[model samples]
Target: MNRILVIGGTGTVGRQVVSRLAATGARVRAMARNPGAARLPPQVEVVRGDLTLPETLDGCLDGIDAVFLVWTAPATAVAPALERITKHARRIVFLSAPLKTPHPLFQQPNPLRAMVEHIERLIETSGLQWTFLRPGMFAANALNWWAPQIRAGDVMRWPYLAAPTTPIDERDIAAVAVRALYEDGHDGAGYVLTGPQSLGQFEQVSAIGRVIGRSLRIEEISPDEAQRELLRIGPLVAVNMLLNAWAAAIGQPAHVTSTVAAITGAPAKTFLDWATDNAAEFRA
Candidate 1:
């Protein structure tokens, strides 16, 4: 059995990866900044590790054969962390954004993209077998974007409601990542993963409303208003990035891919599937 370490194992996608790996009867170790707070299964060994503090990763990487890296640390810490990971893990699967894709949606200025590219270069030259999972818009973003609005009422006020996106489910990303981590032939491969359908922002909201049995109202606001209101939820850069991406996506169809089905032998979950699975979050 491969002893796998999942860095950033407490995040939305990372948590799914950890659970999926554990279900496969693999020796799974989860690295978190706070081990006691990690609400994982009893079988998973949780270790305290912080990417900002590279010294903390030494213990977490011990005897770890393969690693699933979800980097949330600053770009300054990438070099030191990769050095430590390379010493222990022979293979690594990094959760990254679609930086290489030529689509305007992905080409928009994102602060995270520079950091990911830098990390990718380091991993490529580090001599460890590496695979990059570049995922598009996450379907789970609805939780943060509209769950509160839905939980309170039916009106979802937003900007660029006509913008199209694939809204890939995070589980599909994890499933592809799991195969890359333990399996062969995935080394040096970069998988561009997305949901199967190209649905507009309003259509996605309608899908959620249909799944939850509600006739929700989607009020389109200007980008300026959205920036102002969304700032309360995320950082300035993240808010601007989303607004910019959605604004650019309005006149074009979102880039969709079949990599999930190609790799996992099953189609990626639709936005409706995601909404149905998490309908409770939108309930009052």
Candidate 2:
């Protein structure tokens, strides 16, 4: 029995990964600062650990064969955490963005991309088997960015209405991660995951509208206004990166890949599918 450790097991994709791994009857352990708050499967052994504090990772890695790592913190702790992981785990499957892809969507250099690239370099030289899962925009962003406005009324205001993206479902991303964690031949491979079709931000909202039985309208706003609103909610660097990526992606089709089906033996879910599944979020 292989002991698998999942960092950020309580998060979006990480939670699904933990569930999938547990369903396979694998010995799964989840590391979180607050293990008590993590609503994981009864079989999973929840352990208290913080990635920022390298000393807390000491016992968590003890007997783990492979790790599903989701870097949820700053880049400052990445090096030390990687050092600890390399010393223990034989393999690691990392959840990262598609920074190396030449598509306009990923071409914009950001702090997150820089941090991931640095971690990738460290993992490469660590002599450990590593698989990188680089996924594009998440379909769940609709819930975060537009759900509030959708629930309040039939009109949603946002920037980059023409900016296209293949919003990959978090479940699909998790399935691929699970395969890379347990299977062979994925070592040193970087997988670029995306949704099945390219849809613009307006089309995305329309999909949500159809799912919720509403005639929704999208009002495009200025990028500068979007930046200011985003800055109020998130860091300036992340907001700028998003603004730049959307600006670059305008009038261009999003980069779609068959890597999900190639690896997981299933087609990637479309944005409409995601919208339909999460329709309740858009409903009052």
Candidate 3:
């Protein structure tokens, strides 16, 4: 693809995708509601657009050969947005969750998954060459959910400490996505991406502690307590979905995949690596 548009380009994975694509000298445009604050690479064209407003996307897709779509809003506008996208872009690479993956981690029925399934169906019939990057739990979530606790004390209190997950690095996810956007033979593909190894929540916490030179403790709490805490911080439906998924994944290791290595020609990064890279977030 010669020219690419990155929806949600200001986001974690989308920013990295923009950087990678721009590095290769592709004409890149990042669609954001506030282009002034997107702070993308100087070479990346930041366009004012909102996915919730389908009419705003009309000009954003112009002259774009491919699109790196990271759906951030609800699915209400997906059909209209896809209609606009297919009109201009020849290909699309979506950052999506592993909805069809049979692992317990993904098997749970959740509103997020339902929305993703609906979007996937629309993309399938949109006639644009498409690729779905179905990533598992993101390692970056540690910063959002646990950084405050780790920065404050030695004890990491959480629920379902035994739940195993292969947390893929956002950078790795972006690397694979860049390939799918510009490379051939990736259309009509759904790639399940994960980190190199399956690590329990306790183990992941320990990994962070090791990087920061602290011996942290994991205090498992009741699911109800966890639910109450999550309710205070996030939506109830999402909180419950996570609680149920973790409960189901207590003994089951997350499904690991070689797709990242297959596409990027490098082994998937480890949790230790992710912790070390983001060690400052966990430092006391």
Candidate 4:
């Protein structure tokens, strides 16, 4: 009769986590800002709540044994939300990025990183069992960057042609998150998860080519050009973060970790495999 509450449940990773947990016959409640918009399974209890307003989560946490907490709000609200979950849940599984190096972009007072780290610190002293999953760049991010180009045809322009990364499948991150939320022995642990191989931007795009049966061309543009294009497409904060990360990765070693396979008892899927599975999304 154990129930779990999932925050940001309508998001990419959260959807997968909710589905996996529901399949096990566990009572799952999905928290979202717009419950009506969440395309969750019939068994899931989709509740309307916002992380910025912790007061609204009042009855949502009732009788919930554990929480899959994704940092969705600014740093100022993290403590209150954690406290609310702590009042009812015995454990929590947090999704966060690995800390950046040199300047530590994560430590620069940014809301997301500050809140994530603060929550980890709070859980450490709150006597709540916890697990943190710090996965690398998501292969789904390629869908954000390259899917449109693939649909348009032949060419994908990108920066960091030589900057390789072990892009993890979001599903693997969810699998680990689901296990950590319901199981034991993962408490107080941080997992650095990544895909099976380190691939540069061109190689990643080419993998998409093989999957969808198209000869996708790689247009190697400068980081400056990439920045301009990204800014034109979206918000400034995300674009700057991505450009800086790519610049750092150009010279640094690509992070490849066995934590996913180690925790799941199965090898992490490759980028080619990920592209193949999601080929329909990239099709025109």
The model with the greatest TM-score is 1
Q: What TM-score does model 4 achieve against the real structure?
A: 0.92
TM-score of each: 0.98, 0.97, 0.97, 0.92
> How many clashes does each candidate structure show, in the order listed?
0, 0, 0, 0
Question: Could you give candidate 3's per-residue lDDT for residues 211-263 as a string of tens digits?
Answer: 99998888999988998886754788888988988988877678999999999
| Models ranked on lDDT | 1, 2, 3, 4
Question: What are the Cα lDDT values of the candidates?
Answer: 0.92, 0.90, 0.90, 0.83
Model 2 lowest lDDT segment of ten: 227-236
Off by over 4 Å in 3: none
Mind giving the per-residue lDDT tens digits that candidate 1 earns over 152-218?
9979898999999999998999999899988899988999999989999999999988988999999
Those runs of model 2 whose alpha carbons end farther than 4 Å from true positions after fitting are none
lDDT of 2 by residue, 197-281 (tens): 9999888888888888899878999988898876654788888989999999987689999999999999998888888888888
* Error in Å for residue 282 of model 1: 0.6
Best by lDDT: 1
**What value of lDDT does candidate 2 attain over all alpha carbons?**
0.90
lDDT of 1 at 114: 80
